[model samples]
Target: MNHKPLRARRAPEVARAHILAAAETLLAQGGVDAVQMRAVARLAGITDAGVAHHFVDRHGLLTALIAYGGDKLRAMIDATVTDWLESEPDIGVLLAKLAGLYRQGYSGLAVALHAAGWRETGSPVLEKVVEALHAARFTSGVSAPDILHTRLVVAAFHHALATDPLFGTEFRRSAGISGSRDDGAALQLAWWISVTKRALGYDE
Candidate 1:
């Protein structure tokens, strides 16, 4: 298949997008502090001045990145739900996908972004994404009992990924999972998926 090449006039816009994408990855991997201008420039194969030219400053870059992430996240959830609606709509599969997303550390990034948004009194984009996520999970053909169980699963996963190692360790021990912390986390997710599936009246 022949693909049309990007126009030269669009180079600056493409570069800005690359910088934002790199910044988003950094934010996901290490929260706000990791999204340094130099690092983003390096990842995007552009100069720091190039990043600043588009975003003006680190604060400006971060503000734009959060908005980008919120839009991206909402699009992802919407696509997943649209696909489900057209095919075999399985809430269990969607829940498992959400658990996998949490396991990949997106949840930690989201927690950090939410804290920042709360303190800054802004970030309507992130707030809107969160509201949509809550509605998707709790109101999308899920029973009351299933919603309660799903919340329990989310709570457990959140505690398992908590920064307090002692709390996480104790929670893992009480849950009777054996292995390294990461392994225990995987097992916890698996168990929760089974529980959630059953709660949703799925046998497997």
Candidate 2:
């Protein structure tokens, strides 16, 4: 006797979540190019038509993935800011967390999306970080210049970490730093952490 395999039914949201999770895994493994629809469908345990039913096409899926990443980043920033407001702030730890997210291939995906003409109107994630830093530095008065400076600092750090996966090691080597790729990355992260801390007036 032959047995048929069972297919568990999922809610639409659940199915979309599974598809996005599968896409993220592919992105982490081999950047944006690896997140093909059929591969996503196979990894998601769904049919190609099922994947298409949700995403419509690769571009739609990728757009949703970018939005998904933004949501994740926003949540991370919220938690980090809560910790910062409630206790001693550790800028290094915060910066390291930001770097870790970029290292997970989201950075490359972001760049690719931008080159493909996908532009974000604004970043709530950046705004939250800037607000937290401003509140930490000033208790009473509002300084536009200070806020602007904080914004610039955060933007610079974001750009650096986003590009680090692509150019960090070579950039470090050009500056005469020598060792394995991991070593260069570590050194670069440490330097950025320090600079960010100092710029934010968190360093002693």
Report, for every candidate in turn, its global Cα lDDT versus the true structure: 0.63, 0.78
What is the C-alpha lDDT profile of model 2 across 16-135, one tens digit per residue? 999998987887677778889999999988899999999999999998887775566567667766766676565676678778877766677667655545555566566777887777
Question: What overall lDDT, based on C-alpha atoms, would model 2 receive against the true structure?
Answer: 0.78
Where does candidate 2 clash, by residue pair? none
Clash totals in order: 0, 0
lDDT tens readout by residue for model 1, 84-152: 545655555665565555556666666666654623334532333233334555555544444445455
TM agreement with the true structure for every prediction: 0.64, 0.81
Question: In candidate 1, where is summed lDDT lowest over 10 consecutive residues?
Answer: 124-133
Error of 2 at 30 (Å): 3.1
Q: Residue 112 in candidate 2 has what lDDT? A: 60
Candidate 1 Cα outliers beyond 4 Å, as residue runs: 1-10, 118-170, 174-176, 181-183, 194-204
In terms of TM-score, the best-performing candidate is: 2
